[model samples]
Target: MNHPMVVGIDGSAHSSAAADWAAREAALRGVPLHLVHASPPLPGNAVPPPAADRLRHLGEQMLARTVADLGDRHPHLEMRGEQSDDSPATALLAAARTAGLLVVGTRGTGGFDALAVGSVALRMAMAAPCPVVLVPRQPAGAFGDGVPAARDVTQVVVGFDAHHPVSETADFAFSAAEARGAGLRVVMAWALPAESVSPRTPAVTEEDRATWEDQEVAQLSDALRAWREKYPRVTIRPDVVLLHPAEALLNASRGAQLLVVGRRTDPQAVDGRLGFVAHGVLHHARCPVAVVPHVD
Candidate 1:
């Protein structure tokens, strides 16, 4: 059996939007949908027993309601729910171990109102074993009314680094595009060498800039050759831009249904922080962002 698509729920509007997105995704993938709600333990005397009990009860009720609502919408899809005493990140990380895809809202209930991405969502994107999809809340009436707007024409945008290509990241993007029957937009950004830009150095002519851009285009095409064969059905659009990686990706995400980027997992790196490009895209990309972890 395929691993289920797991999503963290916390009775927040963002989480509700995430659940809706996950339900549609689970149905598309023909896999089970697992909902998790975390109610972390409080310090001694932080809350009275009765109050804690009430909180737990409310969490359970929220889980049941979400499950039931999704079931009603996706009657044929397999669904289940779990309430964990662990913190949100801990619970979701454990769930990700056995999940095909882990999903969560961009901002949950506990975070500051101004935060575009919540702490738990960021942590999961960096540390989860599987691909993490962070769904941002859509405009009012975008969901929960009826059918979502058709996304058939919307492409799946993925940031590609030809110099350090990660197969897992490309594979995930290709598969996602294939599943959605959408085109794949591969964005690669490049800049002029620092030395070439210095005043002491000879001015780089238009021909030189064109040659460098061509090289980047060629490298990007070469990197995507295998993925093209793997997912022939997905129309590929290679975009080599003269802009920052984050800016290029954010621009491509304007009408995209999903934006995919890589998070290099360094075993020795104790920080466990997302790479610069991924972090920036996650903060500003309007579309749902998928952070696929891979070893460089």
Candidate 2:
């Protein structure tokens, strides 16, 4: 049978939180948990030494301890951990390729000198082979804070952008919400361009802006009209707010149990994919963010 969730972990507090979340999710799904940790290889020019053996030994110890902790807490879970000489993102991406789901902490056991997920998570969410969940280790209130334990609620808030293909995310969010008997909120955000500043006229005109706003509203309505029809039994609140798409969605996600977004691989991007707003939410959204990659 396939593993339900494959999680990438290091000993950091953030990673521990991710493992906890993943393990709990696995238990909920009645599947196994595959825990992984990765280390970089020695420089090509460097000489190999027997002393390096201790580093691999420590990795095994860390993995063993993590698995033990998880096993103790969840006796029914099938758990295992592995250490790789590859980069964290690479190893986790590979693990994600086949797993039913992939989970990672927004931050990791990296240098104290740098920030987490602000960059690395961006890369993985955009290119990972399967759906990726970036769990925020900090409290649920903000980017860096830790949330106190609450009931394990499973409501899902899905972000919709005209550029994103929403059908798959909608299906996932709906099923997860229904399975947990949780509410679902479908959100759309729109922002109008600033009024043209003219020295000749002191008055700002809402004419052009109104037209743009109307178009946006129409598009959003059209996007969800069919979905609302199909999922009538599901309580979905469709929202429209004036702000950056990323900010609007992130704010809506504050009370959500899960936030879902899509991964866009724009041919114009450096990595050849990654939508602007989706990228921002993946790196900064307060809750765990799921990126449903475009399959076609």
RMSD of each: 3.3, 4.2
TM-score to native of every candidate shown: 0.92, 0.78
In model 1, which residue pairs have backbone atoms overlapping below 3 Å?
none
Candidate 2 global TM-score: 0.78
Candidate 1 lands at a TM-score of 0.92
Number of the top TM-score candidate: 1
Clash total of candidate 1: 0
Model 2, residue 165: distance off in Å is 4.4
Q: Report clash pairs, candidate 2.
A: 138-145, 139-145, 139-146, 139-147, 264-274, 265-273, 266-273
* Tens-digit lDDT track of model 1 for 1-296: 17999999998998998999999999998999999999987989999999999999999999999999999999999999999999999999999989999999998998698899999999999889889999989821243346554443368889998988989889999988888888989999999978777767668989889999999999998988888888889999999999999999988777578899998888786436698899999988777999998886
* Candidate 1 lDDT for residue 49: 92
User: Model 2: residues >4 Å from true position, as ranges?
Assistant: 1-3, 44-48, 112-119, 139-154, 162-165, 192-222, 225-233, 266-272
